[model samples]
Target: MSTTEVLHHHHKHCDELFADAEAAGLHGDWAASAASFARFRDELLAHFATEEQVLFPAFEAATGMTGGPTQMMRFEHAQMRELIEQMEAALDQRGREAFAGAAETLLMLMQQHNMKEENILYPMCNRTLADTVDVAAGLRQRLEEACPVSA
Candidate 1:
């Protein structure tokens, strides 16, 4: 798979977990909601780590563009991380409204972030880093480690 495809798949997987958590929260199942939200947060953070540690470095090295799209993405990742921390606190407090509010903001930010990455950043990475670095492999390995399949 290409870099864009791998990351896009991960985005969809995280979206599913986010939806599950939101549904559980709506239904007043705090335990289930917490579990699902934890999974979503873990997976999303892992994705960010992979991009920052592997893909971004490779792209920056290849294109010599450190303070461009990768920088913006890093900033957004920090925002998401902060929001995730807030969501975790909300969950701990069992504050459904607070959690939902944070989730709503997170969802909006994530949608915009994902679009920018998929459309602009990933394509740039695919063009610049595809031959030099196995970004898709790195992404898949990191994501699999983040959410290993059971069987």
Candidate 2:
């Protein structure tokens, strides 16, 4: 499969995780919320690593645009990671206010990040990196292996 197709599939799972976390938060279920958030964080971290390590480099090579899309994505990933840590800390402290604040920030960051990937980065990679069949296949295989059907 192509990189964009693989990312699209992963995005669905990401959306589900986000929805589950949001539902848990809405219900005031701290344990469930924390679990969901942790799952989301793990999945996203892997996803980001895959992009940073493989997809972005391949895209930059193909398009000859160094420090473009990949740089923006890396920055966004860092922001999200920090927010995830804050959320986890809040959960550890059992502080509702902190949790709520972190959750809100996470939600916004996730939504925007997903949009940027879906609307811009993924399509660009698909078009520009179409010739890198091995790269795309490797990414697809890694993503599939990392995130099982049950996940």
Candidate 3:
């Protein structure tokens, strides 16, 4: 499969985990909710790591657009990281409202961020780097190492 297709699939995985965490929290099961949230966070971080470390660099090297779209994506990634840190604090305290509030914000941010990546940047990556040898290799390596086969 293509690189964009792989990333799209990963997005769906993350979304599922996010929904699981949300459900667990709303169910009032504290331990299960924490575990679910941790799972979601792990997948989310892996997704970001692979995108930032592998995909973005490949796209930038291929397209020579380092200061453009990839820059914006990196900025958004940093913002998401901050929200994640806040979520960590909320989770630590078992503060349901705080966690839920931060999660809502993160979900909104993720939706917008993912739209741009899926519709705009990913297509660009597919078109620009399809012939390159390392695109798929890099994706597979990160997928194997950073993300789980199933979650």
Query: Residue by residue across 1-151, what tens digits does model 3's lDDT show?
Result: 7766777887888899988887777666778978888777877877787788888888888778899999999999999989888877877887888888888898999999999998999888888878463444555665566546551
Error of 3 at 16 (Å): 0.7
Pairs that collide in candidate 2 are none
Model 1 Cα lDDT, one tens digit per residue, 1-151: 6755777888999999999987887677989998898788878988898889888998999889999999999999999999899888988888889889888999999999999998899888888766677666776677677778720
**lDDT of residue 71 for candidate 1:** 98
Question: Could you tell which candidate, 1 or 3, scores higher by TM-score?
Answer: 1
TM-score of 1: 0.91
Name the better of 2 and 3 by lDDT: 3
Task: List the candidate numbers ranked by TM-score, top first.
Answer: 1, 3, 2
Q: Which stretches of candidate 3 lie over 4 Å from their true place?
A: 131-151
Off by over 4 Å in 2: 131-151
The model with the greater lDDT, 1 or 2, is 1
Q: What is the lDDT of residue 110 in candidate 1?
A: 99
- lDDT string for model 2 (1-151, tens) is 6557876777679778878876776577988987897777767776777787888888888888887878998899899889878877877777778878887888888888888988988888888877574554655555566666743
Q: Which candidate achieves the best TM-score against the true structure?
A: 1
